[model samples]
Target: MSQSHTAVTPSVNKVVLAYSGGLDTSAIVPWLRETYDCEVIAFVADVGQGDEELEGIEAKALKSGASACYIVDLKDKFVNELIAPAMQAGCIYEEQYLLGTALARPVIAEAQVQVALEVGADAVCHGCTGKGNDQVRFESTFAALAPHLTVIAPWREWDMRSRQDLLNYLAERNIKTTASATKIYSRDANLWHISHEGGELEDPWNAPTDQVWTLSVSPQQAPDTTEVVDLTFDAGILTHVNGSAMTQTEALVALNSLGAAHGVGRIDIVENRLVGMKSRGCYETPGGAIWYQGLRGLEELVHDRPCQRLRHQLGQQLADVLYDGQWFTPVREALLAAVAVLAQKLTGTVRLGLYKGNITVLGRKSPFTLYSEAFATFEEDEVYQQKDAAGFIRLFSLSSRIRALKQGGLQ
Candidate 1:
């Protein structure tokens, strides 16, 4: 089925593939075995995409010609290790994307590499298309963690140009595939968010219809009543929701339900893909939006102006690094360390209101709050002297005054 122009050479005996039980990956299993003449092992990471996606995935993989299939549960690890740290640093790519798909790539790649080693596979493979960012993300991880293992990207070698080509190839080979040429959207989902692409979304001017959305209702259809939630964070980690202590995964699931009920987070943007193309995508990140707002509220209460400025800089840098698949590098580690220091005092509780795609901070309190009521009072108070501001203002503007005088602009 593969139309590789070059002469076929067997480079490896076995390969561990990053499989998702999807059409591309299902076709990839048989293609790898037939082309490479090697054993194929499938690796699946469950980052809480939901039970429907994972159910019978291993069986499907085995039936697709894989010698073995590994389905690892990465939900808690994903939320705690990847999602939590990114949230703390406020790492949103291009000021809009929550880095949901970007963040999950490295975690999935790392686990895939581990499975490859455990199974004694001589190489690793992925189902990512040549034009997408996941290819870079997966290969970069392979280059960092295990350079000795050969990396096989089938899409680069295969001549399949479209979804139809893949389906036809599989059909010719008598391999069953659930995907069809009429599929409207390409979707990727995890615990953090769901990303939708293709179909009407390819044209940026086209508005997404109701069928395009899965996680949340339309803002117009959202309930009229406002919902309030209490979130508690300790040392940059979300610890509780609405007076109940919970694990990182539990809290996210709870917040996702609440936020989705009110249509909290939905973004549609044309993003710059790592492959030098612009792609249109819509994302639903309900729980993540609420968490970001709550943490920002606490940050305002605790962090000073200088600290906040530096944190903002760190966030931008972290966003780029994470998006570029440089998570395993020293620069990412350094940035995370800096963010950790800034988040040391970010412990507090924040009450937030959710209504029709809006998140508003109702109240916030922190033990390390820098707000001083006496110094900030509008009425006359013993702690403040009104006349002191005259001298302070004069000194602050002295450079401007001197410049004006030298230019003969002031009498």
Candidate 2:
């Protein structure tokens, strides 16, 4: 059951809403004004979901009864500040999800708060439902950044429960909306990836239909011949795609096109949500997959065994923190600092072959690579004395040897 925040709400004269111009937010603009008798300002964060989602957003907000709408272009900052660091650290939630939706929230929420303060708004509202992780992500950020502002979550207050209810409410109010009841999937898209949830995904046993995917083609529908992509990285940040230099954002855009052509990134998983429930989702992240693979290839050459293990641990921890909306904390900064050190020598080029939803490493090269042909040679090598390994192995296994002797199992 959704609890009502308005039962004993604080007085609010103006409120800023994180609006998407979608159904929920479209309804929310008018609801905030009617329910609280406050001025509603629509705030849209453009994190490169696509031009289609952004087109006519301002007009939609105005039609929905917003006093004004502020669209913040967060594309550059999203890739450079959030995605770059996470990508460099190899942060993938639950070993599968690329943290696509999770990574976009903090930057969007931070920008929302900034808009709220700029307009002297008393409250900040979001259309996130109470059952999901986004409510926590958005409100947690608000609490950390602006503790004083009142937070209004309509899902926790309104009687509306379904998309049908939202539609009926809009109709009663004579407000126009593009949403329809037949819209089966719930999708969230940004620069890195697109996520699909709801509908048939509610049943874990069900396989997603072809309609669930919007970004990349089905592997079966992919090209017959393999396409090779060359990725160059400097200090663990993507610097170029193919032979042409590009900004990180531009490189990602190009990579997305190339990888998607061959069906390079697609995953379906049942993941544990931050709210303590298992939910199934499908994700398409062609460019991000290529980016991650390129960095990993570089790490394989540059990272020593210990550094490799430590980086793996860092990735898991950082993923957890980011997924749980803890990105604004000191612990995340500390983890990023460690990742920066590990990534310092990760300048490299990785050649990958993409074909039918697969990415194969064709070659990897790094200036700081630890690989030595002379030492690793199968033939006799003067640089490494194989005979000396016996004593070193004995020393390394001394603890095990002592444990066996103590148990009288030395034989």
Candidate 3:
């Protein structure tokens, strides 16, 4: 209903859109052309979703009445700029999976805004539903980077009540779409993880059937044998796996392969959406589990307990902020600044053994490690003053002792 309200009418010539070639966006292209009488350009960001999703997308845009379609490959930039820093903070949404959708959105929206500027478009558009988090995500980036450009959200304007309504609207216009309401599931996928929602996933108690997953196989169906891989990090950037150097995209691909075979990551949770809705979704982050654990293990070797605690606390808050589409805010920048300081000496090698539904750290080593085997050994150690602990404990428990004594005297 909010989508029905007219945005401040502005003088506009052309609009650039973040197009996905999905049911919603497929309809949006024609709608924009008809309503505004302006040229429409489609912009798609390739963030490692898949070739199948990208194949023939340009033609689809043109058929839907676009002036031009620009598909930008942002895989390398995604992993290096957005994902790498988030990984360093150990950012995980709801303690389940890495923030895959949360991570990709800002970059995608940024690219769309860039295309708008490049094409000299006065307005931007997206097909995100008014109720969903994505509308907020795309619009927030637009507000931050391109405040002058007006945003056209077609989902808010159109009278399509449901997916069926949208399908019919497209059908009447002779626009082709493969999406169907019978599918019962809406999914978003990238290299980091895949998320599933709708149908039974809408109910909190309904168990997700194996059919919902695509990236990682079910743990029950995973291979019986365990697999081991080595990961090396320098100054918080993941540099190598098994002594082989790789680009960020390549390394994630390699790890995803290993993690998928062993069923290392799968999670179902009811998450708080940015729009004040609680939505139930299943997410699979196989390779991400290994990478997160590997980085955490290395951080343990370098940081003290308090620093690690601070990092984890910051990570939890950052995950929430990132999930809420607040990445453009100063809070996110400050969080990243703190993470950078914490990650300065996070240089290490971590060996992980992947087995059915498990990613275990097999071994860990670091040149800048603060762990000392001698000080930590159970066998009588020279570094620790055992007798001094008696005095320390007495001091630590002094308040408790005084409270008990006073209470007893009062009685």
Candidate 4:
């Protein structure tokens, strides 16, 4: 039987929970009921994890004593409003996976807040662990959107020590769970990418096993043939592929098919978590991988070197702040402003080669491109300024020469 709730209890009349139908969230249902003596309204955000994951989520929530279950379909909004903007900015963490989970939080939290208002709930709850980045993400959104609602985080209050303990507790309470005692990996999936943790992935040096990947094939196992893909962008937004216009979601789906077949996007990194720990994870972001590279190619055609460098630097900083879940801050707004200006002229076409997990930019062109053939050609041309390089090189090396002279030439 599940133990009775004893930790911090809510005095509110009703609570809206961000339910996922997962092990932790399933346990949260009964625990919330017993502790708060309040009606629980479960809210599930469907952000394209597929029907299998969401099929019986509402039923499961109701079975666990929730007064009602609300499953909001946020797939279109998620892709257009959230994913598209991040893609335009070419945002990725550690030069690997797009910040999929991190980006999903704000939208999910927003939906949860709306549900809370619709159901007249006085509080909101989530299943995020104390050590995870999601706690910050969800809480920050709540702080920004519905600060009046009391925030309830079960992980910080529950005495559950492990997944095993949760299972045992649920079993004792006759709460059936499909989760087994020995789960080899912990995964978080969405339209963007699938993340793998635990098992071999927890060890930074260990190579990911085949069983760990659910999305893309291993590069070694990819086909021997190469594939070419063409992409078009307009005002920092992806539009056409191979002369066919596609919706944002459709474009991602097509890119994912091509990129995954070529083993294009797989990454393993030890990333710093918001909880002050470095966790190793393997990420597969096939579609996002191709899109980001393609966007950069277009950006390169239009933006000068100095501007590109500044934008890339800003991207790195934005990655850290986004990963840390500071999405509502003024700093984030300033960073996005910089990215918007940099991406304004990013309109062009990019041809890419995909072979055995490698995405290589073959060609890129743009109307606003700064590249000049007359100035770059090897043959003598009217625009040639060969003698001007002497002055340019001297000015560039002026600081170095002064530093050497001040240091006694060779000290």
Candidates' lDDT values, in order? 0.91, 0.92, 0.87, 0.85
lDDT of 4: 0.85
lDDT string for model 3 (240-348, tens) is 9999999878999998888888887788888878788888888888878888999998998999989999999889988887888888999999999999999998898
TM-score of each: 0.98, 0.97, 0.95, 0.95
Model 1, runs deviating above 4 Å: 5-10
What does the lDDT come to for candidate 2? 0.92
Task: Evaluate residue 392 in candidate 1 and report its C-alpha lDDT on the 0 to 100 scale.
Answer: 100
Clash totals for all candidate models: 0, 0, 0, 4
Score candidate 3 by TM-score against the native: 0.95
Query: How do the residues 123-187 of candidate 2 rate in per-residue lDDT, one tens digit apiece?
Result: 99999998789999999999999999999999999888889988888888899999998899999
List ranges where model 2 is wrong by over 4 Å.
1-6
- Off-target runs (Cα >4 Å) in candidate 4 are 1-8, 403-407
Give the Cα-based TM-score of candidate 1 against the true structure: 0.98
Better of 3 and 4 by lDDT: 3
Q: List the residue pairs that clash in candidate 2.
A: none
Q: In candidate 1, what are the lDDT values of residues 306-345, reduced to their tens digit?
A: 9988888898898888888888999999999999998889
Q: Which candidate number would show the highest lDDT if scored against the true structure?
A: 2
Q: After superposition, how far is residue 374 of candidate 4 from its true place, in Å?
A: 1.2
The residue-level lDDT of candidate 2 at 11 comes to 88
